[model samples]
Target: MGLYDIIFYLFAIITIASAVVVVNSKNIVHAAFSMLLTFFGVSGIYVLLGADFLAVVQIMVYVGGILILLLFGVMLTNKIVSVDIRSGSIQVIPAIIALGAFAAILFSIMTSTNWKSESFEIPTTTSVELGNLLMSQYVLIFELLAILLLVAMIGAASIARRDKE
Candidate 1:
């Protein structure tokens, strides 16, 4: 009905559609590119939620860094581009049953919940406060994420090198 609601729905649709594309695409490069759109949609949603810092970080870390690296890895691999990605549907019945149950539960939760209706003021300088909190409170988690990424990259490099040789 409102402009914000329309924008929110638009971004949400873009994010969900791109995520579906990422999941369904057989080509690894196409999936990686779809992930970029998904990340951009998420960044737009973050901006709408007044989380500018999170939006910037999402673009920088996911779109700029991880997606680029993943694309390069896929492109650099020999004969990987021509490989057909086959997805199995062996658990179709179980998946349908699980999805039905989940839908029922989600519907019930949405109907029964007492939702809060409030407007939030957008902060002008969110980066400064977010930076302070990350440094002071969430520094350990932040550092651990960096370490985890480093380990994962090293592992990937080692696996690629082994495959090449």
Candidate 2:
């Protein structure tokens, strides 16, 4: 009906289709690439929802960081690319039944709810507010997390080095 609605549906379709590809693809590399598209779709949806900070975080953390790491790991592993890597069995009937039940529950909930459309001011920028809060109130926790990640990296490097010897 509207541009926003069209964009939202597009993102939703992309997310769902890519997620299905990620689940069903036999090749791990293709699955990872599909997952990248799924992440991008989710970030687009977040942007449509007026959550700019979350959208950026989704892109940066999932696409920029995690997806790249996953792709690199898959590429670096010699045995994974050579193998078929398909699951031993498929449970199509059970999956279909579960999907039907979930759809029914969702339809019931949607029908039962009294939907209201109200306009509210969406913040133009959330990063500034978040940064202020993190620096002022949650600085200690943030610093601790950084330290923990640093230690983890050091430990991982040491383990890798020991394995080489």
Candidate 3:
């Protein structure tokens, strides 16, 4: 009925369709690309929900970093092009049953809940406040996380180097 609702539905449809493609595609490469579209659709939904930080993180971390890494790993692997990567649907009946159960649960919840509409201002930018909090309140934790990632990177590089020797 509204433009926002239309856009939300559009993104939701795109996400669901792309997720199905990712699951059902025989080719690993195609599945990975479909996963990229799924990530983009999720990011679009985040934007619509006024979670700008999460939207950016979804694009940057998932689409940019993880998807690219997955694509590179798939491309660089030997003999992947010749591989049949078709996943058999061994649990189709069980999966459908579970899906139906989950849908019923969601429908019941939606129908039972008394929904209220409230008007509130959503922040235009959360990054500045988040940055200040990280710098001031959570600085130690942030620094520790940085150190942990650095250590992991160094360990991975060392292992790769040793493998080459």
Candidate 4:
């Protein structure tokens, strides 16, 4: 109907389609590439929602950092990266039960929750405010994330080293 609606739907479709590709692709490399497209679509949606900082971070953190590392790991490994996806109906009963439980919980939440209908103003200085909050209110959590990333990098390096020896 409107330009915003069209753009939102376009991004949504791209995100969902790419996500499906990422999930269903048998080749790890292709799946990783599809994940990049999905991330890009999500980042676009974030930008549309006036979350520029989040959009940039999504691209940088997920596409640039994690996805690159995943691709590198898959490419550099000696073992086979492509996995055969099995669709056996061995757990049909359990799957049906789980789906039913999930649907019931979702329905209950949707019916019971008081959803907000009011529109909120988007702050122009979102990045500045976010930066200030990270430095002031959430410094510890920020530092912990950095430390966790460092530890993960070290672990990955160690694993790669072991593979060589």
TM-scores, all models, native as reference = 0.74, 0.77, 0.78, 0.77
Give the Cα lDDT of each candidate.
0.86, 0.88, 0.88, 0.86
RMSD for each of the candidates:
3.4, 3.2, 3.0, 3.7
- The regions of model 1 sitting more than 4 angstroms off are 76-97, 115-119, 146-165
For model 2, how does the per-residue alpha-carbon lDDT over 98-154 read when each residue is reduced to its tens digit?
999999999999999998979788879988988998999999999999999999999
Looking at model 4, residue 50 earns an lDDT score of: 89
lDDT of 3 at 37: 91
- Ten contiguous residues minimizing lDDT sum, candidate 4: 80-89
Instruction: Report the C-alpha lDDT of model 3 over 1-165, residue by residue, as the tens digit.
Output: 999999999999999999999987877888999999999999999899888998999999998888998888777663676676544557778988999999999999999999997967888987887889999999999999999999989997887574544
lDDT of 4 by residue, 27-146 (tens): 777888999999999999998898999999999999989999888877666354545422223666897799889999999999999998787899985899899999999999999999
Q: What stretches of model 2 exceed 4 Å from their correct place?
A: 80-92, 99-119, 158-165
Candidate 1 clash pair list = none
Candidate with maximal TM-score: 3
